[model samples]
Target: MKLKSVFINTTNCITPLGLDVETNIRNISKGISGIRLHKNLVYAEQPFYASIIENSLIEEAFSSVSSSEEYTRLEKMMILALMPVIKKMNPVFDEKTILIVSTTKGNITQLSTISETSAQSADLSLMAQKIASFFGFITEPVIVSNACVSGILSLAVAKRLIQSEACNQAFVVAGDEFSKFVLSGFNCFQAVSNEPCQPYSVNRKGVTLGEAAAAACVSANGQNALAEIVGDGAINDANHISGPSRTGEGLFRSVERAMKEAEIKSEQIDYINAHGTATSFNDEMEAIAFNRSRLGNVPLNSLKGYYGHTLGASGLLETVIGIESLNSGKLYPSIGFDEMGLSQALNIITQNEEKELNYLLKTASGFGGCNTAVLFKKAK
Candidate 1:
């Protein structure tokens, strides 16, 4: 089904860089890196660090939802960040607003404390449904929890639903909280970085894990005055679940399809927000895929240096980041890069520079060999 018009109405995020998009963009565009030492984590005494959202700020922003101590941090973050925005939309209680939420590690980060699953248990879908119920939506919310790609894929699903007229509108919210579960999983895979992640760097080692949550409102037609979701696509690597494709083949295919769906030629892409997780294999593989796509030279950058790998939220949040960058006509640098890696000629926007951006490309690759590409066109 062809959508008459599906546009991103409103977007917001809660990241380590800052609580909201405005604050996050201001710091990112200024080339500010947000990774810091997590003295409480296993290697906090050592050199490794993480990009964690300030606890105080999160408490302040999200306290209204779970005023008591019932809700978990991740749940509160989603509810608090989305409540105001959703209310502003003035949705009706009985209106069918589909909720497509994404998360790599949901409230499950805290599930180890409880063995039995119950209504009060912190099921990821329950967290999403709680938010939906609070907003008075009558539709049954569908939850998507596909590793880091969940967030981006959630948006892609929402866009399709709008195109199919399955719902009048869809609320895409995704989040992942930092926990020993996530850190240990990555650590077991040796994906922790001793320093802030440096994407596209010759000396890159591993990813610096981070936590965040984000929400975006998409409608059948453009109602809010903002960027439109012009093109989007997703694909599986079918190669590896934990590691990226050797030649970045899956990512390359995803980008190719996404650009085609948008009817955007490779040259038309003005900027690319790469899923540069700061890992040796991931970065190099992405480099190879991007180089093969020939869009690597499209003035690429990774916000991971600033916000770390926000996992699921990385895609939607970074899509928001790309829109902000395009609207402001500024390109951000890939933080922590001292040396260029691989033989690819992809130009990493290594400095905060001003440029006229028309279409910004956002790409994300995650576990299970999932990759997503979304092209957001600047409203002319």
Candidate 2:
């Protein structure tokens, strides 16, 4: 059976660098980075580098559209990121339109500062419902929080739903805010970076945490469509709880499966937007996976150096930017990378350059051995 085609209609991002695609792309093109040294506040004993959106900025943006004055930071950011896209599209919020929210730890910060309303504030379902209700969505919200892959997985889920005729359109919003709990948890495993992350680099230490919210509209008949979500594959190695498979078995299989579904050869890929969290294992594992899949020669770059690792938001956020790159015929450099670090010799974009991009591959690997690969074709 021929599957129905799904496309990303509109996109929005709320990041430290900017709140829209154009601004983020401009700053990224100029090599501007949002990751910076941040003083440890109830998370670490020392300062650490991360890409964080200013609370004041989030509030200002939220206040402009809302007046409740009681929304949590996470809610505010998610709403702000989603508002523009929904407004621009003016999509109907009927039963045919579904709201899918992807987040790792929704309102987790409430745990650090428990209050009388802490229980409700920390409820993921409640947060999802609140956001959906705000937009008057008739259907219940679907939550996808599969570690860091939540963002991209959400897109995959929406595509499948559209193809299944379960929904005519889907509004996918994903976000995660930095919190004492999240930072301390990563610190416990010594995965927090001390400086700006250098993904796919030999000198890379670890991942720098970040916070951002991104949203996209997906439908069968895409208006202002940027790219078509052609194929996707998700797999898990069950190797370890906190670490990825040493051989990148899961990632390799995932990439292979996605490419097969996409019906494209390795050489047909124009570029790769890797998950490159800059961690020792992640970058190394990706190199092995790409080489094993015969995609080692494709030019690739990680956006972590610019926005750090925004956990659940990274996949979708990067996918949005990748679409922009495809339209502009430009590839952004992998900042903070000066040399090859992995065992396999892989192509890494060192500087911004123009290229004819037709098919782009976005991959994400997260804890619990979860890995996902998504193939997108430039919309004709």
Candidate 3:
């Protein structure tokens, strides 16, 4: 099905890689791993390093927000990323466009402090409202807290909102920050890797969490979009919330639905940006998922090594990287990978930038067995 009017005008973000687009692309394309010992990891006595932006840089970028809570970190990120888009974004505020947000543990870092108080929860919706209000789109805010796939789900939500004529335009934002609560949860699952993840590799460990903030403007007029979002879909394994289907059954179905919506044959896809978290189970399952999805032997890359798994931000953050990759005619390699660890020899990008290709697939699978994939066509 042809989309009537969905245009992604621009993308931007602040991540562990860099502050802006150019620097991030440069740092990430080099396959640089940003994982290091967290200076404050002594709080939990667990060695966990995530992609954290400097507090001073963020303060300078997002002057409108202050307060050193989880919201502050993500708020600063969204404000910085939205700065560029807002500079060129021309839309009627409060009436023209709508705001959509996605995050698994939205501002939950503040919960442990306030949970025992009168306010038993950290309202992520309140934070979303604050963001939209900051951008002068204080009319309506759509919040999606669907676990890890929140980023892509936000994209699909924005696209559908435009298609449904609910709004003339839509601004999609996704972000997440590392916190003691988040770290402890992953630690409970024993999913946290001590080293950088080797996606689709033989000597793989578990996933390393990362923090990031990202936003994009999707409009109906995509004739000159930076990247064309061909098709996207989301599905759940229903097997286990925190674990993946050993057989990759749910992921296979998710890819199948996405291709069906794209109306494009599987072989036409050129490369795949996998949700290669470097976790032993995730990597193994995704390998099977991709191969069964008819994406075997396709050049694949994962940015987790450089950005760590940016949790909620991975979907959009990686999407931004994918777009940057297409625009620059370069493909990033899967970092920290030495051997082919998975059952099959899944072709993973591990060297210098490869030549630009037309169609590529970007996928993400997270807790709750949530699986998502989006196909993109490089703008000609």
Highest TM-score against the true fold, candidate: 2
lDDT of 2 at 221: 83
Which residue pairs come into collision in candidate 3?
5-220, 6-220, 7-219, 201-341, 202-340, 202-341, 241-368
TM-score winner between candidates 1 and 2: 2
Location of the lowest summed lDDT over 10 successive residues in candidate 1: 39-48
Instruction: List model 3 lDDT by residue over 95-201, tens digit each.
Output: 76888877777777667665454143357777788788777885679987877778877887787778878887888878888778888888888877776666666
lDDT of 2 by residue, 1-380 (tens): 99898999989999999978889998998999998888855666788888999888988888888999668899999999999989988987788899999999989988776676886679999999999988889999999999999999999999999999999999999999987788888888888777799998889989899999999999998556889998899999779978989899998998898899999989999999999998999899999999999999999999999999999999999999998888788999999898899999889999999988999999999998999999999987
The better-scoring model by TM-score among 2 and 3 is 2
Model 1 / residue 379 / CA error / Å: 2.3
Please give the CA lDDT of all the candidate structures. 0.79, 0.91, 0.77
- lDDT, candidate 1, 1-380, per-residue tens: 45566778788888877777888887886777778876774333354678888889889876655576767788778876676568767765554578778887677665666567643476766787777776777887888887777878887888888888788788888888777777777888888877788888888878888888888888865754367777887888999878888988888998888888888788998999888887888788878888787876789888888888888778888888888888888888888887898666778887788888888888888888888887777765
In model 2, what are the clashing residue pairs, if there are any? Answer: none
**Candidate 3: regions farther than 4 A off:** 1-5, 41-43, 64-71, 114-121
User: Alpha-carbon error at 26 in model 2, in Å?
Assistant: 1.1
